[model samples]
Each structure stands twice: as structure tokens, then as C-alpha cells.
Target: MTGFVVRRIGFYTFVAVVLAFFALPLLWLVTAPFTDTPTYEVKVPDFTPANFQAIVEHPYALGSLVNSIILAVGTAALVVLFASLAAYALSRVRLPGRDALLYALLLLSSIITGTAAMVPLFQLAVTVGLIDSQLGLILILTGGLLPAAIFMLKDFMDSTPKSYEESARVFGASPLQIVGHIVVPLVRPGLATIAVWALANVWGNFLMPYLLLSDVEKQPAAVIMYTLYTEGGQPNLRLLSTFGLLYSIPVVLMYLFVSKKYGFRFHGGIKR
Candidate 1:
């Protein structure tokens, strides 16, 4: 009894500490935007709108958010579309070395990240007239994200009972129709998962947009936030914290919306 009590106390204490460790930064993010002068150390925020006003006054602050939305949405759509098709095909059709090929592609994408291939990517962008273009940046992001996405979604497709597709086919459904009507509806959680993942990845991404895009107005919030620093290299905590607060809201809202709509739980392609 004594040992059990001690262990329970220790586990609760550890959990509490972990919660505080994460909660403090989040608490600061929520409160700092309302403080007149945001500081590094968290405190009771002196309620004020000065931080938001400062952000609005900045020339590109709001515009950067719009740019980020465009990029994130565009990238997510493309990644989800390609991943779904590829995942479906891979799940349904068994070709030689299929599993090996999928794992190899995922492995290669992980190893050759955007940073590692930036030089070649830049050269390709310049060759294809994608440099300084938002569409170009979106295309690059979509390419980088597709491999992992397709891999992640393949299991969801596999879990779907073949009886559903077989039934659809008996009713004269084409492969594309079966995918669009039956498979897609059944595997919605997977699609939602990929969409959210792709959006989050694109939302926080800085490197691809920074390397591919040169125009100030075209820069996303992740890249734009870097310019919030002071000239002497110190971070402008006020602007940084304020923008950080707003910068995080969209993704959070998106997550909440998706969670409410489809949820993240997977149950063998059926909601049961």
C-alpha cells in the first residue's frame, strides 16, 4: 500500500510538471498579445490592444497571413488529391516490390528534405520559371509532402473492406466512381488526417517558400516572422509574440473544425 501510494504520487507529480512545461509557453502565447509590452518572462498580461494595433500598422503583417493561407490551402489540396489517388491505386493493385517501393520512396523523401535539395530545387525552379512564384512554391511543397502522405493514407485504404468496392462494381460503378463515391466516403478520416497534416506542414514551413520566393509581398507568415527581429539581431518580442499569437490561430481553428467534423480516430475505414 505504501509503495503504491508513493508511486501514484510520483506519477501525478511528473504529469503535472509535464503539463506546466507545455502550458506555460501556451499561456504566454495567449496572454502576451494583450500586454502593452510583451516580455520573455510570463506574467499577468496588462490588458491592452497596443500589440494588435502595432501589428495592423505594420505594412505586411496582415498580408503575410493571407499569403500563408493561400500557400497552405493550395499545398494541402494538391497533396491530398495526389496522395489519395496514389494510396488507392497502391492499396488495390499489387505490383512487384510494391511495399518495398513505397517504403523506399518514403525513406528517400525523409532523407532528402527541402533543405538538403534546395540548390537543385532552386536551379529547377529557375529553369521552370517558378522562382519568385507562389504557384511554384506550392508545387514544390506538394511534391515534398506527397510521399509521406500517400504512405500514411495507404493503411486506411487497406483497412477498407473490398466488399464495398466489389458491391459498387456490381452496380456498374467505374474504378474512378468507386474511388470517388465509395472509397472516399468510407475513408474520410484518412483524407481529413492527410489534409490536416499537409496544412500544418505547409503552415509552419519556412525553407521552401523562402528559397523559392523572392518578393516581399509573396512571403508567407512563417518567413515573414523572421523579419520581425531587431536590427542588432535581438528578437522583437512584442511584435514576435503578437504575430506569433495570431499566426497560430488559423491552424488551431482548422484542427478544431476538422476534429469536430470527422475526428482523427481511425476505425478500419468505418466509423464503428
Candidate 2:
């Protein structure tokens, strides 16, 4: 009894420590933005709105957020649309070497990451007159994201009941109609999951956007945040923490909205 008690105490203590470790950063993020002189350490904030005021006055600070939304939304919309279609087709239609093709694409995408393909992608963008264009960046990011999105969504498609689709077809439903009314509704959780994943990925992405978008007005929050540094390359913690807080809000709000809508728990093809 004593041994069990001691082990339980130790486990709880370890868990507390881990929770505190992760919570410290969040605590700092919430407090530091309101602090008069924000720093790395979390402390009682002086409760000033000066940091926010400073951010509002900075050129491109607010505009960069809009640009981020544009890029993230555009890329995610395309990814979800194309991935759903491709996954549905792949799931319903068996082709020669279908599994092999899916696996090959997934493997290639994983191995040749954005960094590895950066130079080629840039050159391709330039050749196609896509440089410094938001639409071009969206297309590039969508292509990079599609393989994995299709792979993940295909599992959801496969798990969906074929009987429902068959019932829809009996009503003389076209393929597009069946997909729109039946498949999409059933796989909404998966769609939401992919959307949130894609949003977060593109939201935090700095390298591709930085390389592709030369104009300051076209840069996203990720790239703009990089510029919030001192002349000597030291971080201005005040602006950084304040901008970080703002930068994090959209994704957090999106996650909360998605979680409330779909509950994030799924079994087979249904949201549980």
C-alpha cells in the first residue's frame, strides 16, 4: 500500500511539472503583451496598452495579417477541394498500381521537402511569371500540401459506407451530386481536420513566402514577425510578444470554432 501510494504521488508530481513547463510560455504570452516592458521571463504585467498602440502604428503590421489570411484561406480551400475529389475517386475506383501510386507520391513528397525543392520551385515560379504574386504562392503551397492531404482524406473516404453512395445513385444522382450531398456531409470532420491542419501549416510557414513574395505589402505575419528586430539583430521583445499574441489569435479561434462544431472525436467515417 505504501509503495503504491508513493508511486502515485511521484506520477502526479511529474505530471504537474510537465504541465507547468508547457503552461509557462502561454502564461508569458498572455501577460507580456500587456507589460510596459516585456521580457523573456513571465511577471506581473504593468497593464499598459502601449504595445498594442505601437503595433497599430507600425506599417504593414495589420496588413500582413490580412495577407496571411488570404494565403492560408486560398491554399486550404484549394487543398480541401482537390484532395476530396482525388481521395473519393481513389477510394471508389481501383486502378492498376493505385496503392503503389499513392504510396509513391506520399514518399516523394515526404522525402523532397519544401527546403529541398525550394530552388526548383522558385525557378519554376519565375519561369511561369509567378514571382511576387500571392496567387502563385498559393498554387505552389497547395501543390506541396495536396499529396499528404489526399493520403489522409482517402482513409476517411474509404471508411465511408458505400451503401449511402449506392442509394444516392439509385435516385439518378450524378457523381458530382453524390459527392456533394452524400460524401462531403459524411466526411466533414475529416474536411475540418484537413482545413485546420492546412491553415496552421501555411500560417506558420515563413521560408516559401519570404522567398516568393518580395513586396513588403504582400508578406504574411510570419515574414513580418521576422522584421520585428532591433538594428543589431536583437529581438524587440515588446513588439515580438505583442505581435506573437495577435499572430496566434486567428489559428486559436479557428481551432476553437472547429472543435465546437465537430468535437474532434471520430470513429470510422462519422464524428463521434
Candidate 3:
């Protein structure tokens, strides 16, 4: 009885510490937007929307959010479309060095990150007349993400029954029709997963948009938020916290919506 009680107490204590660690930041995020002169400490907000007004007053604050949405939506659409097609092809076709090809692409993507290739990327963009263009940034981000997205989606594609495709083929459905009408329906979960994942990646991405876009008007929220600091480097915490809370809402809502739609629950994979 003594050991059992001791272990229970220790477990609850650890859980409580973990909960507090996460809860504090969430608490700040929720309360700071409505706060007057927000601070780092978690306290009851004074309940003013002045922080929001202050953010609204900033020239590019709201506009940056629009740009962010464009980038995120564009990138996610491109990634999901290309990744699904590539994954389906890789899953169905037996090719020499197929797995090797996928792994090689993934490995290269990880090693040569956007930051590492920024100079070359910028030069290429300039050569192609895509510098400071949203379409250019979307294409760049899509390329960086495609390898990993395809790799992840391939497992889902493989898990789908090939019998469906065979039946569709018997009906004289074209390859594109089979993919659109047959394969895509069976892999809805994979599509949803990758779409949400891509949105989150592009939404919070700062460095890519920062380097690609030069005009302040063209900048996304991630880049524009950096300018919230005073010239002396003192952060405008009120504006910063408010904008962060607003900035986080779209992705959080997207995750919740997708999870709810797909019934994102798991059963035990490892048995005791």
C-alpha cells in the first residue's frame, strides 16, 4: 500500500508539472489579446481590446495575415496535389531503385535545408524573374516539402487495396479518372493529413518568405511580426502577444477541424 501510494503521488506530481508548463503559455495566448499592456506573467487580463486596435493600426499587420493565407493555401494545394500523384505512382509501380530514389530525395531535402540553399535559391529566382513574387515563394516551399510529403503519403497509398484500381481499370477508366474517382476516395485521411500539415508548415514559415519577399507590403505575418520590436530592440510585448495569438488561431482551428472530421483517435499499437 505504501509503495503504491508513493508511485501514484509521484505520477500525479509529474503530470501536474507538465500540465502547468503547457498551460501557462496557452493562458497567456488567450488572455493577452484582450489585455491592456500585456506582460509575460499569466494574470487576469484587464479586458480591453486596445491591443487588437493597436495591431489593426499598424500598416501591414492585417495585410500581412492576408499574404500569409495566400502563401499557406497556395503551398498546401500544390504540395497535396503533387505529393499524392507521386506517392500513388511510387506505390503502384515496381521500379528498380524505387525505395532508394525516395530515400535519396528525402535525405537530400533534410541535408540541404532552405537556409543552406538560400543564396542559390535567390539567384535562381532572380534569373527566372520570380524574385519577390508570391508564386515563386509558393513554388520554392512546395519543392522543399514535396519529397517528405510523398514519402509519408506513400505508406497510406500502399495500405490502400489495389483491388479497387483493378476494378476501375476493368471499367475502362483512364489512369487520371481512376486516380481521381477511385484512389483519392480511399486515401482521404492521407490527403487531409498532408493538407493540414502543409498549411501549418507554410503558415509559420518565416525565413523562406523573409528571404524571398523584399517588399514590406508583400511580406507575410511571420516576417512582418519581426518589426514589432522597437528600434532599441525592446519588444512591444502587448502587440507581439496579441499578434501571436491571432497568428496562431488559423492553424489551431485547421488542426481541430481536420482532426474532428477524420476522427483522429488511435488504438494501442503496443500491447502490454
Give me the candidate number with maximum lDDT: 2
lDDT of 2 by residue, 88-179 (tens): 99999989999999999999999999999999999999999999999999999999999999999999998899998899899999999999
Full candidate order by lDDT, most accurate first: 2, 1, 3
Q: Which window of ten consecutive residues has the lowest lDDT sum in model 2?
A: 263-272
What's the residue-level lDDT of 96 in candidate 2? 100
Global lDDT scores for all candidate models: 0.92, 0.95, 0.90
TM for every model, in the order presented, reads: 0.94, 0.96, 0.94
Clashing pairs in 3: none
Clash count per candidate = 0, 0, 0
Worst 10 residues of 1 by lDDT: 263-272
Q: Listing every candidate in turn, what is its Cα RMSD in Å to the true structure after a full C-alpha superposition? A: 1.7, 1.7, 3.5
Write down the lDDT that model 3 would get.
0.90
- lDDT assessment of candidate 2: 0.95
lDDT by residue (tens digit), candidate 3, 198-225:
9988998999899889999999999999
Flag the better candidate by lDDT, 1 or 3.
1
User: Candidate 1's residue-wise lDDT over 89-169, tens digit each?
Assistant: 999999999999999999999999999999999999999999999999999999999999999999999888899889989
